[model samples]
Target: MTCGLFQILMISFFHLIELSSQQETRFVYETFRGQENLYLDGSATVLPSGLLQLTNALHHQMAHVFYKESIGLSSSRQLSFSTHFVCALVPQPGVEGGHGMAFVVSPSMDFSHAESTRYLGIFNVSKNGSPSSHVLAVELDTIWNPDFEDIDHNHVGIDVNSPLSVGIASASYYSDIKGKNESINLLSGNPLQVWVDYEGNMLNVSMAPCEVQKPSRPLLSQHINLSDIFPNRRLFVGFSAATGTAISYHYILSWSFSTSRGSLQRLDISRLPEVPHPRSEHKNLSPLFIVLLGFLAIMGFCTLTGMYFFRRSKYAEVTEAWEEEFGAHRFSYKSLYKATKGLTRMDFLEEEVLEKSTEEISFQTEK
Candidate 1:
């Protein structure tokens, strides 16, 4: 009986180890445009097994939405997943635009049922607004709307409970493709990088312009207890994009995810080239530049001080020469008293008496 119990205990320990090994840290799914549902060329590529690339100029209504469902995560385990996508607007002038793209996590892995134009194409029409069903979408919206032009051209939003019943939780107007109510300046498509972090009951979304020096701060943050969305813990992760009439391509470059046990580690930003600044023409110095600026400022201060003293000295020399030529001229106290004689109180009283006498004499003369 002791030996049998020991064997069972060993088996149970091995089983637990196997379960722990199954949890996934990083998962990348890339689908190109054109080739067999994958949209754009050179935008999406699958390097070996784990690595996936989503590049520019890719679009397809029916592309292979690559997904990794069992990221080795159990219901009890908590995870933080982030997706990095490199999407560029296809340079088409007059094409009617479509919905942009989304990072979605739901109970279903079926991509066919997830189809909607403006609404993230991932809703069960059967359970349209039902909270019992599983649905969550983080949308990167590119299209414009009359109601919410308050939001930016490229903005991030979250849709929970159902896809049909959606709301723009967060959004920011980005400078890339510019347009007014009628027409917009279609500059070269600007690349957008977005980050979404979900920890415990908190969900935070942040984005940086591709050329920005620093990663963008969180644009919108909403804290909903995970229990509100899903009673069960594990969720399948995938991406969806749709081009309704006018074809706009979307691409996912690379993605990484991590769980509580540290299953998937994200690549450090130090490993990648620093994101270029949007205004590269302005040669603004970093903190190191402040030191040189301080030196220059000190030099400027010294030069200004020297110039002021030199001008003051020159003025003093000129004044001395003028004083010598003028033979130290002075105003005497007697001259000052004579100049102010009309201002004395006695002068005022005498003037008043004279004015009265003059008035009387003038009256007699007139009579």
Candidate 2:
């Protein structure tokens, strides 16, 4: 009856949920790339330093590079990618830096109309905020874009088909010890990593230094559907950057991409060089410290052994003393029987009568 119908409905609902979860876990495309697969344009080059340089410190320059194929992005699917990159602003005398770089997905690989500066070389000024641009970007912005009403000069932002970020978070890392966000200079020439994920109509962006672990909390996350903007579901994936009067070097050391219809996997860090650290600033334990540690270890062992033997010897001495004192007083059963008088009723009565007669005679004599 009604209960049966309700049960059927519940079963259908659970099945739908299970299907959704399965779709979310699937990846349609998954691959990794190094410098060889990255196609560079404009000022971008494969540096001898093993980084795919997107832009040099030249003024009013724009560079856009993308992979050779068109990636599919569907409404029901999750798409994710990560980039290991570094951007360093080259300070010049009395010159201002324009903008930073972006991980972008666009309709085509052509950047002929893409402008530099605040546009990040992905969109021109005319189409910067237009809905028809058909572009999705995660920006690592260095300079503030006043016209766009940016939250801060340095931040991570999620952009959908426009330069305006639907959501933004100041570029920072999660400090596990502090349990809070710790700001870092993005233009400090340090290698950084960023993850971009689009799942169930939400776009999430997370960033941190290469030396630091990836923060669980995404810097910027927003709800958006790519199907609305990208009807064809095919798009070009790559990076873009621009320099205004100010300049910087933009590089991508490695990149990994995956789609929701495939297995979830982490970015392959082995293909890239380890993040650079200063050797001179590094410190290790001194020889004196090692010697002290060894001495303390030996002393601790000796103390433990001494305490163990001391307690054992003390216990043995107590046991021996107890046995010696108790063993010496043990007497035979015959001596105990004499102390209590023999178990004979007639002898006990005769002894008692004799004592009474003696007592009576003594009393008469006294009288």
- Put down candidate 2 lDDT per residue, 144-241, tens digits, no spaces: 87677788887888887677888887888777767888897777666677777776777777777766777878777788877777776677778898
Deviating ranges (above 4 Å) for candidate 1: 1-22, 27-60, 72-77, 124-126, 144-154, 164-188, 213-216, 227-232, 260-367
Best by TM-score, which number? 2
Lowest lDDT sum, 10 consecutive residues, model 2, at: 24-33
How would you encode candidate 1's per-residue C-alpha lDDT over 1-367 as one tens digit per residue? 9999999999999888767755445643332222342222222354333223332223445333545444433445445555554434433344444456677776666656655555445554666667866677777666664443325444566778564324353344233334211122212344555566777657776555455432434556777555456665556666666554545555444445554423444434333322221232456568988999999999999999999998666434223566777888655434554688535547779999999999999999999
- Candidate 1: worst-modelled 10 consecutive residues by lDDT: 179-188
* lDDT by candidate, in order shown: 0.53, 0.70
Q: Give the TM-score of candidate 2.
A: 0.61
Predicted structure 1: lDDT: 0.53
Judge candidate 2 against the unseen true structure and give its global Cα lDDT, from 0 to 1: 0.70
Alpha-carbon TM-score of each model against the true structure: 0.52, 0.61
The parts of candidate 2 lying over 4 Å away from their true place are 1-36, 74-98, 261-367
Q: Name the Cα RMSD for model 1.
A: 20.6
